[model samples]
Target: MNKVLLIIQREYLTRVRKRSFIVMIFVVPLLIFAMGAIIALVAKDSDKLSSEQVVNVVDESNIFSDKFHDVKNIKFKPVKASLEQLQVAAKTNESLLILSIPADYDKKNVVKVFSKKKPSLLITDEIGRQMNDIAVNNSMLQHHIDPVIVKSIKSNIAVNAVELTDTGAKDANVGPNMAVGIACAILIYISLFIYGAQVMRGVIEEKTSRIIEVIISSVKPFQLMLGKIIGVGLVGLTQFGAWIILSVISTKIAGEAFNSPQGSMMGALAVLQTIPFGYILGCFLFYFLSGYLLYSALFAAVGSAVDSETETQQFMFPITLPLFFTYILSVSVLFRAPDSALAVWLSIIPFTSPVAMMVRIPFGVPGWQLALSMFMMVAGFLFTTWVAARIYRVGVLMYGKKASFKELGKWFFYKE
Candidate 1:
């Protein structure tokens, strides 16, 4: 135990003293600001540039738009002569497509639209829908029917879904449901990958430099591995906490600058107001610590077991695939059926629960559901650490020869 504490102190101090640690603790906020500035520039340019679309309107009945609507991106030219004019305009890039309305075309039925470009389908459909509505309203007015009645008939019907139980008290608003869940999941994925890869690379570097052999002479292999994991984990948390602080300060400044009611920082601040913020936060802590610890341990073991970084490629896919699959499935389940059995089971399963449960939390979860998921994640971390420590004990010393899956299995059974 004394050796473990000494190793932990050594590992923590060694990394924290490096220039890289100081740069990392402060650089992320500047990068985030740069990203925001880039996004604003892009948005401003996009707004200034008009979306280009061509319309060859053949109003055979001589109804509207002879000269065209003189928008900067879109130009409307009157087709007085023939169908040939429309076709020519389309071919020459003067227009995108042709819209033909026959002279005898009945105003009572459906409208016809023709477009060569499949990408313009939505634009054409929207135009057709707008024209249809205009025609219908004009016809109704001509007949002296009350427009209010038509308006009432076309009004959007809304449904209210009130939950009887207050399962997700911290996340009550439907507005923040998907966004909050997605943010939490993303935070978990990013945190795990960043920290786990760090652990892997650190192990490889130390082992390659012959530093591990010297350290191993003074410390047990398991103690060295555990200390490194805890130290790196603390570094990650430090960076993460710094980011949170910087984001909050920047957000408040931006919100005050905007002076808008909805404001720039509402989405971010909502994380605090998320009903049952405790559950979501509790899960975030559980999943992040357990998820990263579990994966980092595996990475450390692989690092100790392998001769080089390239050798880890064969094993990384197995570790990464489950997290990726869980995230994708969480997105699908968010809109499809958040309460389905598949979602429920996925949230409870440790391999996927980091993302799946985060996604489900906003929708509300049963007490047993959260408890069971937390328990499984804790158990997974403990079990994985045991296995990793066994492999790490042997792998930290053996070199030149590449380790295999079969060898890793043997390491598990090897005597202490």
Candidate 2:
């Protein structure tokens, strides 16, 4: 136990003292802020960034002669020139498009569009909508019906979701919940890969340099593997803790800079208050640690069996496939139907529970299901650690031989 503690101390200090680690701890939050700033700037100035496009219309139908109007980045002008002339003009003007409405447009309900380049969906859709509205209004007039009456009959509805709890009923912030769920799942998915790979790389480095040979004389392979995993896992937790603190400080500073009664800060805080951040944070920490432990053990085993980083690829894919699968399903399927059978099973399965369960947490998972998932995660971690220790005990001493799946199986079953 003392030796494992010493190993853990050594591993943690060695990484935490590195310049790269310190740089990343501070740089990541700044990068996130910069990205947000860039997106906001672009959104605020989108109209200035986009050039207006001109559309030359040849409306032989004559119904839309004076109806075409200019919108944000598009201008419509009725032209007497034929389609061939418009096409010729469009070839010289890259920002110009030609729209042709045949005399029989009412029958075919189709209009031909030509451009030097493929037009944007926004422009095309706007044009289609305007033309359709005109055609519909014309038909209504022919039938002696008023378009205003039809427009007045249209309705827009807004729905407010309310969740019922044992205490009472409260408003549910569905958008924020979905965002938080997806964000937590993605963070866990990324952390598992980042920290797990760190363990494998650290093991491979020590083995390749023959440092493991000297260390093994004092400590068993299992102790060393466990210490390395825990040490690296702590490093991940530290980084995440730092990120949360820094993000909060940054957000507070920004909010103060733009503070007002009706400002975004107040609105954001109101939205955040409705979310169960404490519960979500607790689940995230549990799953992140459990998932890291479960995957890092396998990563350490892979490191032991391989001589170099390149050799780890063959074993990494199968280990990582479940993470990818669950992440995709969590975003696409689980968010929409958190109570679905497939989601329930995915959240309970040890291999996928980390991401799957995090995605379901914000949507309010049942207590029994959450407990069962947590239990399975612990079991999965223990099972993988035991198997990895068996492989690690033999593979650290192996050298100059390429390990295959069959070789790894033999190592796993080797006698003490």
Candidate 3:
């Protein structure tokens, strides 16, 4: 235990003292903010571009009783003369081109688009299309089409979302689900990237600098591996807690900046302040740590298995496949049914539940279900850590030889 503590202290302090870590902890968040702002600004310009498009709506349906001001970004030109007059005006510099709905337009036939030249991008033929559809649909209705089917076809479909609670008086909203899902995803991505890379770089550094010899002299191989994994995992958590604090502060400031629309801050703070939050957040922190430990230990095993970065990729994606696949499927199914058998089953799978459970929790899960999920996660994490330690014990000493999946599996079964 003392040896493990020494290893943890060494790993944590070494990483914390590095300039790169110092820079990244501060710079990355600012970069994220800048990128978000730039995207918003570009979208604002795109909205203005939609307004810039000038389309002359020539309604030749002749049944037109009112002005066409309701058409978005469309200009209405009521024709007093022939279609010939409009075509002549269309050829002018007023607008690049035009699509004219003909007066003789048969409702059952193709609508004709009259243009002197090909329509420029600044011109939209959407109004022309909509008018043609309206005319055709009007014809169908005039022929007395089935009203029931017509109404059903035109009606909007909505899915009812509700939470089944045992005793809680309050109901869950989509806002919390969305916020928690997004937060959980962010946490998972950051932990995996940060800790996984730490494992890789640690292996590479030890292999290159011959520091493994000194470390091996003092502690057993698996003990050393456990220490490094735990130490870095702690570093990950410390930074994660700091980031959560910073983000909460940022959210508060943003709310003030934006006037806290619909009492968003108060609602968020209210939820955070609840007594159950301690348990919920405790579950989050524990699962996050355990999940990272499981994955990062394997990353260490992979790093020790390989001599260089190029060879590392061959092992990395296969490891992350479970995390990515689980997250996608969890999010996809959360809307269809958050409490279904599928959701219930997935949240129990350890590799998946780090993300899957977090997404489902905001929607509410039964007590036994949450307990079972935590049990599976802890058990799975312990099992993976043991396997990784065995791999590390052997692979760390091996030099110049590449480790194969088959070879690694063989190591796991070896009687040491």
- Candidate 1 residues lying further than 4 Å off, grouped into runs, are 30-47, 57-149, 157-171, 249-278
Local accuracy of candidate 3 as per-residue lDDT tens digits, 176-278: 5666665675577567767878877788779767789888989998888888888898888877676667666776776676565467556656555442455
Q: Which stretches of candidate 3 lie over 4 Å from their true place?
A: 28-46, 49-51, 54-171, 253-280
Which pairs, if any, clash in model 1? Answer: 169-275, 169-276, 170-274, 170-275, 170-276, 171-275
Cα displacement (Å) at residue 128, model 1: 6.1
What lDDT does model 2 reach?
A: 0.92
Please report the candidate that would top TM-score against the real structure.
Answer: 2
Winner of 2 and 3 under lDDT:
2
Residues 1-416 of candidate 2 have per-residue lDDT tens digits of 99999989988999999999999999999998899789998999998987888888899989985797799988998899888988988899888898889888866647878999999898889988999899899999999999999999989999999999899999899999999999999999999999999999999999999999999999999999999999999999999999989988887787787778798767886788789878898899999999999999999999999999999989999988998999999989899999899999999988899999998899889999999999999999999999999999998889999999999999988888
Order of the predicted models by lDDT, top scorer first: 2, 1, 3
Candidate 3 weakest ten by summed lDDT? 63-72
Instruction: In candidate 2, list every pair of residues with a backbone clash.
Output: none
Best-fitting candidate, scored by lDDT: 2
lDDT of 1 by residue, 13-131 (tens): 77778998888777878886888799988887963665776666778766544523444454455556677765665565633666677766666443354455453455555566656
